[model samples]
Every structure is written in C-alpha cells, then in structure tokens.
Target: MAVYTQVSAEALAAFLSRYDVGDLVSAKGIAEGVENSNYLVDTTRDRFILTLYEKRVAAGDLPFFMALLDHLAGKGLPVPPAVKDRDDREIQQLEGRPACLIRFLPGVSLSQPTPAQALAAGCALGGVHAAVADFEPTRANSMGIAQWRPLLERCGRDMDAIRTGLFDRVAAALDAVERDWPRDLPVGAIHADLFPDNVLMLGDEVTGLIDFYFACTDIRAYDVAVMHTSWTFNARGLNPSAGVGAALLDGYDRSFGLSAAERAALPVLARGACIRFLLSRAWDWLNTPADALVMRKDPLAYLARLDWYVANERAFA
Candidate 1:
C-alpha cells in the first residue's frame, strides 16, 4: 500500500517487453493486498497483473508456487494460470527483484458478499485442496512447526507481557497444539492464507484466487481454518461469521467432503490459523525497520480473533 515494492514506469515497461503482450498502454497499481506491488497493465493485447515481489515472499520458492497455480488450473479449479516466459521459467529477475506477470483474473473483491458467495469461496478453496491433494511440487512451508515453534520459544519468559493482556493462552495453546494437533488426517498443499481479500468474487461466485505465496504442503484442515478466519471474523473481533462459515463449509463439503478427522480438527486448525497470523503480524510489527514503508498489519486484529476462538471454542457444528 505504501509502495513497498516500488517499480518505476521504465522498469515496468522493460518487464512487460519480455512477454508476448506488447505495448503497455497504461499501468496502474491495483489495491487488494498489503504485500507486493500489484499493477493492472493494460496492453494493446490484453490486461495482466504485473507484480513486483516484496520482501515477504522469497524468490527461491516462486517456482513451486507458480506451478501450483498451473496444477490447479489444469484441474479446472478457479485460479490464475501463471504465464511463462519464452524460456519457460515461471520467475525472472526484474527491477532488481524476482517478479512475475499473471493474466488478470476478471473479478473484484467483495466486502458485503452474499451467503452464496461466501460458500462459493469456501467450496472453491476446498476444491483446491482436493485438486492438489498428493500434489508433489516443491517448497516446504515457510511458516510451519519448525518456524512456529521457535517463535513460541522466544515468546516464553513473559513475551506475552510485551503485548500486555494479549493472547494469554498463546503459550499453552502452542504446547497443547504441538502435542495434540491432528497431523495425520490428510496432508497436502494448502492456500495457507485464503482470506476474502485474497479471493475475487463475480456476481455471487468465486471467479479467481490470488496470492500463492503462502501455499505449501500442510494439513488440509488448516486451509479451512484460514478461510474461517477471513469469512467468519471481523476487525472488532467477533464470531458472527459462523453463517458465513456454514456456507463455506457447505460449499467445501460439496466439492470434497472433509474426513471425520478433518471435521474434528477444523476448529483447532482454525484456532492455529488465527494464532499463526496473530504472531506473524506481531513479529513483523516488532521487527520491521523504521524506514520500511510496509505498515505491519494490526496484531490486535488476530488477538481479537483469538479471543473469539476462546468464546466460541466449541460452538462450531
């Protein structure tokens, strides 16, 4: 939002020139995310998303992420097919950063989406899980147990005091989670951050999904967890989103029915997803350099969701 991945017109032009589409008529920033500088490039041929990768996404993993999109697209899942260069490499260096261009998905992000659309997003995400199940691409999760555990370890010695009255059970949650969290239900690639903002809606239907940076091999239920966080939680931190969750779950069930184990783990996976984002936001806030244009997302947002989890811990059907 703050030009975190700044790209000048000259640089953008050069990036576009390498592709089949020629003559960038106009390039303007498209705002539906806090990370990555995304621009809608109107070319003489067609429109496309020109993304200048940011620090949050490491370039090394771009291949697997891009391939996953290709994989899903082949499966008839609603996803943007990553355009390849003449050399067939999914990623190329540009503007001193690893960059990519994807065909612009035709849809807009909805704020007051209908119940049908919410369910559609959920089901579509589930479709992704089904499509990519046993998907053997590459790229391990950048934020998995190994990464998450140490962050929790550092949070020991009263790091909870840093945020103050925030996420009191975070430590305990992590401990019990490591010991008891469902690990064997089903594991595969997940859109680990499938927030509403990351998905596009077209007339009460999910038309396209964006942001594969967080995609990786993990528990399938965690994907459901991330969706619940987005569609079911609000900024003030309330769980009035259950109806949305029901529609989502319904849609997901229609696509690929969850196992009994996955259903049982959904609430806990949702809680883990909540805390994962919560800790990431807090860490990013605390670690961001002073001059960075990237304004860290409010850690309070996730903390509120955590509270919502505690209040409705066993409320899900």
Candidate 2:
C-alpha cells in the first residue's frame, strides 16, 4: 500500500460513479507497502480500499489475486472481499492503471506482535492454507528462489556499499539454498508474505490477513518459515527471541501437520526467506524514488535475519 499514483477527488468521484458503493466522501493515500497505490476510501455506504496496480505487479496476475481473495472470503477467512463494479468486473481502470475496490477489513496491524498474536497468526496462516487448498489459479512466486540470482546480479557490487562482503554472503546463501532447496514437500496456495503488518488484529483475535498481492502456489512449510522469520524475530530482524517460533510452528502443526521433509528444510527455507527480503529491501533501498510514498526498509535487517537463521538453524527443530 503506497501512493505512487495520485488520485484526485474529481477523478475518484468519477471512478466511484461506476460502483454502488456510494459517493466517495474522502480518500487518503496509504503509505505502508511498496507494491500498489492504496487509498482508504470512505463513502456514504461503507469504507473500502482502492488500489491502483503499479508496475511492480504484473497486470496479468491481477485476476488471480482478486479471485484468490474472493475465494478465501467465501470460505469465512478473515480477508477483504473484492468488491465488484456494476458490470460485475472485479477490476477497473483508473488513471490508466488497473484498479479494484476491496471491502475495508476491520482491525489494525501490529508493529511488534505479542506471543499471543503470534500464536493466532500461526493458526490463521494454517487456515489460509487450508482455505485455499482447492484454489485452481496458479501464479509462480516472482520473488522465490529462481529470481534470487538475477536479483543479486542486479544488485551487483552496490550491495558492498551497504556492508562489506554483503554481496558474497547473499550469493553464498542463495547458492546453498538453491542447491538444497526442497523438492517433494506439501505444495499449495501459500500467502508467501505474512509480515506483521499484513496481519490485522483487534485485541487478541486476528481480524484479517490483508495484502494477497504476494500470494502464490508454493511449499506450505515455506509459508510457515516466512511467518516465523517475520513474526518471531525482533524488529531488527535478528534474534528469534519472541520464543514464539516453536509455538507458531506448533500452532500450524495442529491444523496441518508438518512433514519430516518440511521440518528438515525449515532452516534453508528460512534462510531463503531472509535472502528474499534482503535483496528486495536492498534494491528498494537503492532504487526506489526519494519522493515515492512507500518507505525504504533497511536491507541490514534481513541480513541480521540471515545470520541468525544460519547460526540458529538447530533452534527451528
């Protein structure tokens, strides 16, 4: 959720004219994520989210994302429902960009999640996997292992500017992960990105899982690994000291049992998760425009996570 594309009141009003969501009262740009242009739209009827798909997100993949949300919402998952227009189209064009209005989910995202939140997030993630088990749309993870090497090459020696030997460390981690990447694990629709900010909570209950933009078909345990790295670790992305790593995994196991292979591959999957974010943050740190509405996250945070994962692989057991 960012504001790469600015929406004028008149333009937004004209856009909303196509929908029965009522006249737009106010719309404000949300400045959290780096992918799409998001605006909180309030109307006489109800509140909603308006997202203008940015270049980072492929236009062709929009249907899969919209349909996935529709499917999950139908299953009673706490996710936003994709609001369709009068023509019954889930997506529309605004300012020459593909856009959609999603029902505004209730609750706020946690910055530093509590152990209880972690436990609930674990259960919620398992439910997400189960809910989407039969979803037929398949979108390959654009940020998965296959893209790591190319992402590294694009970063090239500039990563050394962030820290000495940073490029080599990331390259080696990529090599190790790709070489030993799991081949035969439970695969299905995984959220792929379950960061703290993506999970919304009101009190102890997780009200919604927003941002299905990174959702894809992949190893289910890899989703657990992503959640563990994001939720259990400290803000600095080091020291999985929340003591919720095991508890989170335990929570997931109660819903969908983790296989021996998934357990054994946890370490590498986690390391790959670290690399995925590190490279992304590094690239955004260097390339994202200074005036962009999105925040530039520190690449070093994921670097710390990578180090911790390497040293504490045994702890995941």
Candidate 3:
C-alpha cells in the first residue's frame, strides 16, 4: 500500500506486456501503508493493484500468500483475487523485486468505524476463518508471540530514544505476554492484520476485506483480539471504548462461538496484539527514512494503545 520502490512507465509497460491484462493506461503510487510499494494500475481492459514485495516480505512465503488469496476469493469472501499472467503465474519479477497484480476491488477504507461497521468487520473475519477451514496450505504466524521479543531486541536501545523508560515498559509487557500467551485455542488460518485500513466499506455496508498478506495459521481468537485492539480505539488514542468491542465480539460469536479458553485468553492476546504493532511501528519509525515513499507510522500511537490495553483488559472481554 506504499511506494518504497519507484517504477517507470517504460518498465511498467514492459511488465504489463507479459500479462494479458491489456495495455497500460496509467500507474500511480499508493502511499497509504507502511509495507510494500503499491500502485493503482489502469489498463485498457481493467484496473488492478500492482504490489512490489519489499524485503520485509519473505520471498519464500509468496506462494502461501497467493494461494490463500485464491482460496478465500474462491470461497466467496470480498477479497480481491490475484491476477495471473499469460503464463498462468500469480507472481513475477519487476525492477528486481517480487511483484503481483490483483483485481482492483471497490469500496474505500474507513478511519473510524461505527458499531454497525464493527459488526460487519467481525462477521467478515469470522467468515474468513470459516471459509479457510478446508484450505490445505498452512503458514506459521511470522509475527507470532515468539518473534515479539526478538523484534524488541532488534529495536534495542533505539526504543529508549522514542520515549524515556519506554523500552523497559515494553520489555516487561513482552515478557508477561510470552509467559501467559495461550496454547490451546482453536487453531486456523487467520487474517492477522485486520486494521480498519484493511477493511473496505461502501457507506455502512462492508464491501471489501483486502490485504491478505498477513494471513497465517494461529489461534482464531487472536484474530479477534487484533480487531478489538484496532477497532475499539478512538481518535487521539485517549478513549478506548468497550461498546465497539462488545458489538464486534457479538457479531463474530453469532457466526463462530468462542470457547471458554478463547474468551479467557482474549485479554492476554489483546496485550500481545498491542505489543506486536508497537514493536513493528517502532522498528519502522527507527529504520525507515523520513522521506521514504512510505509514511512511517508513529510508534507512540501503539505505545498509548499498549498502555490502554494493560489498564482495560476487561474491556476486550
């Protein structure tokens, strides 16, 4: 959803020639996200999204990512399907980076969601979990609990620079999460990063659920925990409300009931979610160039969220 790598018109035209998608009309960088270099591509025949997989994405994992999209889309989720080229390939090399094209989906992402929208997001996530029930492929959660500490360690002394005494607090939280992280919740393929920007809406109606790049096998409830942490926070990161959390859980449970264990572990999982994002944002904040095509996110935003979750673990219940 961002453009770290630049693509020229001639290069794009050469790349488009390999596909039967038609002649390229225009290509524009999309600067919304912090991950890959993305562009909205318009061709004579259709509009598609071109994503240049950056180093953050492992090349070995591309097959799993693409196949999962095909599975979810085939199962009738609102996800965009990856476009295949004339060779029937979902991936190709462009500018020496792994890239792929996906059919452009309608609807826009919402910054702040209503309770009804929260309900729809919950239902959509639940539906994704159900749809992938029979999908044969499995990829481990690359950003799962085990990786958080290492991410923090990589952040190292740089974290203290972000906020005095911030490293210790985050380290303490990471340790606590590692100690109490759940083990036996129902396991399935999950859309691990379901932030509001990843969900698309047409007014109050849920129209699309994009970005399956973070999909992996993990506790289904942990996915719900991501939703709780992401969707329940208000603007300015001051007010973390339970009403949205309640509505989301209510909607999800209507489709897939949560186990006693899942419910009990939700608070800890919410803490883990906060830790995951905080570490990632902090890492990006420290490493990514200020003027990079990608907008570096503020780690303090998630730092505030981590603190909020620590104080209001019961709110996620």
Candidate 4:
C-alpha cells in the first residue's frame, strides 16, 4: 500500500487508455500493500486493481507470477486472473509505472475467520498447491531463508532489551534449518506469502489469493509454514489459541498430509518460518520511510514467536 511511485491523476488516466477498459471513472490509491502501489481503478465498464510494482518486485519475474495466477484460476483455484492488455501483454506502463491490470475477485478478507473459514483457507491452499505445483515457470525465492542470510548479516545487530528478540537464537536455528531441511517431501511451486491480506474469502469459503510476489520453487511444507504464520496467529501475533494452530494444521493435513519425519520437522520449520518473517519485519522496520502509507508489519511479533519457540520449542522444532 506504500505509494512508492508518485503517480499523478493525469498520468493514471493515460495508462488506462492502453487497455480496453474505457474511461477511468475514478482512481484512488488502494494503499494496503507493502510491496506494490495499488489503485482500485474504476472504469465505465468495470472495477480493476491497477498495480504499480515496487522495487521489491523484479520486473523480469512478473510474467511467471502473472501466468501462474492465471494457471491456478483456470484450474478453479480461487484467485484473481491477470488481465492481459491490448498488445497481448500482461503488464504495461501506467504513468511511467511498470504496472499491470488485474480483474478483482469478489470477497471479504477473512480477518476474523471462523473455524470453517480458517479450515477452508487451509484447504484452498492445498488446492492452489495442487494447481500450481507443476507450472513450469520459475523465479528466485524472494522471501526464502536463503535470501534472508544477507539481510540478517547486514541488520543482525543487538536487540537484547526486547523480551522477544530472536537475534541470538535465530543464528543457531537457521544453521539447523539449513542443514536438515527436507530435501524431497514434494517440491514445485508454492504461494510463499499466503497471508490474510493475500487471501480473499466470501463468508467462510475462500474466493481467491493475491500477491504472488513471493511465490517460488520451494518445499511444500515450508510454504505451509509460511502461510501458518498469519492465519495461526492472534491480534497479538502469537498463536491465538492452540486450537487455531490445530485447526489450520488439520485443514492443511487434509490436503497435503505430513509424514512422521515431516511432522517431526514441522516445529523447526515453524521456527524457521517465524525467523523468516522476523527478518522481513525487521527489514521493513529499518527501511520504511515515515510517510509511507504501508505500516511496517511488526518484527516484535515474530520475535515473540521466536521466544515462544525457545520456551515451547518441543512441539515444533
């Protein structure tokens, strides 16, 4: 939701002209994402999400991510379909912004999901995995553990005053994760950022998933762990109740069951999962400009998760 790219009103209207979408009726910043500048665009004909990707989203990788979403939707996965433009392109320049148009899927985001809704998000994730596992295009793991090493190296200073600082424990946990991470449970493509904001639902059933910026070739369970980070946590960002984790785990297990070894690995993966988010939150905290519309998602939440892992380390790692 950060307005990184400065787009004037006139410039936005001009970008709309390239598409079949007639006459931009109204356009305003749909500032709800940290990675992209989004405008909920209205035209005489319909409503659309116009995304002006931030630097975090590499321009080269847009096609693969866009195609993957379309592939999943075509297979009946609940998600928005990328709108191909007049030049038969999925992405176009909007106000000097490297942007793309997408058909908005209908639904409410499951902020306070029911057991049914939480469970469905789990099921929908599995369905999406089924739909996307074999899609051939590939991209770098933008938010993966491997990618975190450099950031952690640069930003891994002291945070000992904090009750939930993971800076000390994470170094050791990361080593174990790197060494023992599952090599062959099932690997293909996965929606790496299946957070609540990215998932849309109508009532208890899911409608679609957005924000494939983090999708990549990775271990399936790791993706599950990544998703579990958001859905499994409460407003305070700890597990809301044990039942939340159990429910989400149950729903995911229904789709992609885990083995005894995989189950043994789940805690560590979940810990790894926490660190992954902790690092990203730390990065955003350190880097976000004050006026940025995007609120920095809390790093302390993940740090608290790390402390939770250290205290109750047995269940997961």
Candidate 5:
C-alpha cells in the first residue's frame, strides 16, 4: 500500500456518504507497499481499508480482484472482500482513481516469520489454489515472464546504478530462465505475490491473506516458488532458513499435493520468481516518484536472491 494520490477530508466524507459504513472517524495513508494508494480508514461502525488503484493496477482488473476475494471469502478463507456501497457498487471513483472500501481484517503482517508461520502461510496458499480451481474468471499474469525483458529494458543501464554488474547478471539469468522455462505445469488462479507482508498472521495461524492485487491465472507451482523465495529468506535477501523452507513445502504438500512435474520444476520456477521481482524492483527503484509516500525497495535484494537461486537450483530440484 502507498499514497500517491492524496484524498481531501471533504472529498473522503462525501465518498463515504454513498455507503452505509457510517461517519469517518479517522483515515491515514499507508506507505509500505509500492502498488496502489491505501488508507487505513475507520468509521463509526468498524475499521476498513481504502485502496486507490494506481501504477500497474488496471481499472478493468478491479472486478477480477473483487470477485476473487468474494470467492475466497465464500470458501471460508480469511480474505477481505470489497464492501459495497448503498447502491451496491464495490468499485467507485475516488480522487479520480478507481477505489474500493475493503473490510478490515484483524491481524499483523510478520516481517520475520518463523517456521510454523511459514507452514500456515503455505497451507493457506495451497487452499487458495484449491478454492480457485472452479473460479471461471481468468486474468492473465500481467507481470509474467513475457513482460520481464521489456521491464528490464525500461530500467536499461540504470540497473547498475543500484549495484555494479547488476544489469548483466539479471539479463543472463533472464535469458536462462526464459530459454528453459517449464511448460504444461498445473495452471490455476494464484496469489502470484505471496510475500510475507501480504499474509496477515496471529502467531502461527494465518488469520488473513491480504493484497490480491497481483493475483492472476498462472502456473500453480509458481505461487509456491514465489512464497519459497519470500518466506524463507530474510528481508535483506540473506540468511535463508532451511527449516522454514522445509516446513513451507511440507505444509503445501499436505494441503494441496504437488505433482512430480511441479516438484521437478521448482528450481527453475524459483529462478523465474527471482527474476520477476528483480526486474520490477529495478524499475521501481529508478522510476518511482521522488516524493511518493512508499519506500523504494532495493533491487539488489532480488539480485542476491537470483544469485542464490542460480547456485542452489539443484537443492530445490
């Protein structure tokens, strides 16, 4: 969540009048994520999240996100669905950007998760894949492999500005991943970006899975790969935990069994995941507005992850 667009108090009050959520008690902009503009909104009745779609979030994709959340919530998953207004509209214009009021879920996002938490998160992710098996709506992975090269090209030589020789390393990794990318893996709707922050946890139990903005139809194992990269490593992309990684895989296997092909392709899938984040972070590092309320993540973190994945592919395989 980020705050690129500032919503005025009068404008916010007028917008809330359309809903039955009650008078606004307080609203604060969230400045953690690099995606949409988010506000922690509290009304007389309850707390909620106000998200304004920005950056890579397309307006046409809002319905897909809302429907996916609704479907997950209906399946007993702890996903926050978009709250509809008095006119039953979930998507509306706020500050000239497509916005939605999300039901506030109670939990804290873990920065340094333990093995047990990783297990629960993995199980929850597997359950999501299972629940979405019959979800008919299809939205392509906008940040998929096909878009990586162009994103990197957009970053261009500036990649090395973050770190010496970063550009070439990423480019070589991208080439290898694209050339040897897997085919015919199990495909389904996936959260796509299951970083630890996206998961809301109470102790070891996953109370909520927030931020489905990057959710899409993609290789099921790719989601696992994304989680593997995100959950098993420290924020600096150092100090990988074998215990956490093992627990995560075990939990997912128990919840939703992985086929042999999926298991065999994990190493490559993991490298692809690394490349995806590396390029996106590189782009964001160079281009994100100087005055944006969001923190500019270091692209080198993913580069470090990419290096680790390349060296440790055999272990994953």
Candidate 6:
C-alpha cells in the first residue's frame, strides 16, 4: 500500500482501457503500508484497488496469491480477488511492474478495535484455516524461522541506531526461538501477516481479510500467534489488552479448535513471531528509501513484545 512508483493519469487511464471496468474517474495513491504501490481507483461502474507489486513481493509468486485469494473467496471467505480484464487476464503490466486490479471491498480497517471486533476477526481467521485445509498450492513462508538470523545479519550494526542493545537482544531471542520452535504442528495456508489493518470490519463482523501478499504455507498455530501479538498489543506496543486477547483466542477456538500441542507451542511460536517482525522492520527501517510514500515502522515495538512474551510465557499456556 505504498507508492514507490508513480502512475500518471494518462497511463492509468490507458491501463484501465484493457479492462471492462469503465472509464476512470479518479485514482489516488495509498500510502499506509510498506508493500506494493496501491491506488484507490474509481470508474463509472465502481471502485477497484490498483496494486503494483514492489519490494519483497516477487513477480513469480503472483499466481499463488491470485489462486489463494480465489480459493478463499470460493469457500465463502470475505477476500477480494483480482479482477480479470476483457481477455480474462487477472495479472497485467502497469508502470513497468506486474499489477492487478482487485475488487475494492467495503469496510474500514479499525485502528482501535473492540473486543467484539477482535473476536470476529479471530473467527474469520479460523474460518480461513478451515477453508484452506485442502488447498493444494503451497508457498513457503519467506519470513519464517529460518530467515530470522539472516535478516538480522542484513540489518547489521544499524540495529543499535534504532535502540541501544537492540542487536544483542534480537540475536539472543532468535537463538531461543530457533532452539525451541516446534518440529511438528498442523500446517496449512496461513495469512502470515494478520495485523489489524489487514482485516476489514463492518461493526463486529469481518467484512474482508485483505493483503494476501504475505500469505504462505506455515504452522496454523503460528498464524494465531502472529494475530495474538498484533491484535492484543497497543499501537505503540507498550500495553496488552487481556480481554481482547482472551476473546480472540476463544473465538478462534470455537470456530477452529487448536490441538493441545498447538496450545503448548503458542508461547514459543509468539516469540518467533516477534523475532520475525523485529528483524524485518529493522531491515526495512535501514533500507527503505526515505522518499517512499510509506511509514517506516519501529523495530523496537516488536522487541518490546518479545520481552513481554519472554517474561509472561505462561500467558499463552
């Protein structure tokens, strides 16, 4: 949802000509997220999201994402699929990048979600897991456990620039996570990045689960752990919301129950989640161009969550 590349009005209109979506009325760049160039496009017919893949999103993986979205939509999940053109093509070339025109889903992404909303999001996530149980396509989690240390190394000494002693803390956390990460757990297609902004809600119901760019085949419980860390924490990552966390897990369990082993692994899986984001953010913080139209997130936020998980391991137990 960032604009690394600018698309001119003329070029955009020309791109729209390939589709049956009607004449473009207006297109505005979206600057919230750190991946892909996104535009809120409106036409005579309706609105659609125009996304130009950028950064970590590989062009080779586009089909997997498209298939996953279509699969989820087919199973009644509130996921937006890429809109095909006159030639029935879902993927297209726009602004010298592989792009897609997605159906714009209704609902605002909540900044401060209530417990009820949290519960609904949990249920929606559980439903996604259930829906994808038989999904054959698999994409490896690029940011999974194995990539943590290498990502940190890529960050190098610049890590301490974000915070003193950040490097050692993240390195040590990585060691512990690598040692304790579970070998065998239920695996399936997971929305690896289930941050609150990724889930669209109308009232207490989840209207959409957007952003399948980071979706991959990974531990089912790891997805829960990622959601737990993202949803249960404040924006600043300073405080935990117990009621929201409890309700989220309860809702998920009610919809798609977790095995006893998965429950036992949550604490460790949570630590891995923390490390994953911590390193990626650190890398993005150091490397993302200053002029990019996206907010650079703080790596220390996840470091704080890592500390919380280390001290309160029993919270997940």
Question: What is candidate 1's lDDT per residue for 180-269, written digit by digit as tens?
Answer: 678678778888888777788878878889888888888878888788777776654564666787888888888888777788787777
lDDT of 4: 0.75
Candidate 2 on 124-147: residue-level lDDT in tens? Answer: 998888888789989899988899
Candidate 5's residue-wise lDDT over 1-317, tens digit each?
A: 89999999899999999999899899999999899999999889999999999958999999999999999999999999999999999999999999999999988998888999988988998899889988999999999999999998888888888888888888888899999899899899999999999999888899999999989999999999999999988888988999899889888998998888998999999999999998888888888998899987777788778789888877564
TM-score: which is higher, 1 or 6?
6
Q: List the residue pairs that clash in candidate 3.
A: none
In terms of lDDT, model 2 sits at: 0.88
Steric clash pairs (candidate 4): 1-32, 1-33, 78-208, 79-208, 267-316, 267-317, 268-316, 268-317
Clashes of each: 0, 0, 0, 8, 1, 0
Q: Which regions of candidate 2 fall more than 4 Å away from where they truly are? A: none
Report how far off residue 190 is in candidate 5 (Å). 0.5
Q: What are the lDDT figures for the candidates, one per model?
A: 0.75, 0.88, 0.87, 0.75, 0.91, 0.91
Candidate scoring better on lDDT of 2 and 5: 5
lDDT of 1: 0.75
Kindly give the stretch of ten consecutive residues in candidate 6 with the minimal lDDT sum.
234-243
Q: What TM-score does structure 3 among the candidates reach?
A: 0.97
Better of 2 and 6 by TM-score: 6
Candidate 1 — number of clashing residue pairs?
0
Model 3 agreement with the true structure over 64-140: per-residue lDDT tens digits: 98988888889888988888988898889999999998899899888778888888888888888888889989999
Candidate 1 displacement at residue 89 in angstroms? 3.2
lDDT of 4 at 184: 61
lDDT of 6 by residue, 1-317 (tens): 78898999999999999998899999999998888999999999999999999858999999999999999999989999999999999999988999999999999998787899999988999999999988999999988988888888888888899998889888888889899999999899999999999999888989999999999999999999999999999877778998888888888998999889999999999999999998888888888998888888888889889899999989965
Model 5 residue runs over 4 Å out of place are none
How do the predictions measure up, each by TM-score?
A: 0.90, 0.97, 0.97, 0.91, 0.99, 0.99
